[model samples]
Target: MPKDARNQSPELDPVIHPINRLRICATLYSAGATDDRQMKYSTLAELTGLPADTLSKQLKHLEGCGYISRAREYGSTRAKDTVWVTLTEAGAQAYVQHVEALKAMTEGL
Candidate 1:
């Protein structure tokens, strides 16, 4: 492998390795490809096809790892409230590095 590819050989991130967490990170990363974007909680739930509780649990784990951040916006009615999720800078870097590492590991296979 080239030096650059070798340099990319970091371990797959444990925090984002789980299938659900990987899906969440991938969606968030692609959604914000052009800019630092935030996705609504409901939208994520729909995309992931995960039950609310399960998604919440996965998100909580990411947040605890400093890989994601969440904010709540309140409207006049409780039903109008929105929760937004964004991948943090550190999170983005970690995700990219993990992908690179995967690529590196598979280069000669």
Candidate 2:
């Protein structure tokens, strides 16, 4: 666990601390354990049980933080477009560090 220099407390990543964001990161991490980590936007939405709009907002925020990236394949219709989501290398590292911090904080309990 990386700690603050002054207080020596484990640091939690604010971007990944939200419940929904945490779930999204965990889902992406689990998918990454497989051969291919890239997941379709709709598939991610289904797995997370999050509405499309909500998922889109969360993904946007993660992308802004360089935690995730999205690629879009245009189809005939906007609804038919396929958006692929993947966790970036930086994102994977941040998620792992965040989880470790969480574990360290809870280990005493």
**lDDT leader:** 1
| TM-scores for candidates 1 onward, in order | 0.84, 0.86
- Backbone collision tally, model 1: 0
Which stretches of model 1 miss by more than 4 angstroms?
A: 1-8, 33-35
Model 2, 60-83: lDDT tens digits are: 999999999998999999989999
In terms of TM-score, the best-performing candidate is: 2
- Candidate 1 lDDT score relative to the true structure: 0.86
lDDT of 1 by residue, 1-109 (tens): 7878646556889999899998998888888821367899999989879899999999999999989999899988989999999999988998888788777778842
Angstrom error at residue 35, model 2: 11
Clashes of each: 0, 0
User: Cα deviation in Å at residue 95, candidate 2?
Assistant: 0.4
Model 2 alpha-carbon drift over 4 Å, by segment:
1-7, 33-36
Residue 95, candidate 1: Cα error in Å is 0.6
The lDDT of each candidate is 0.86, 0.85
Error of 2 at 67 (Å): 0.2
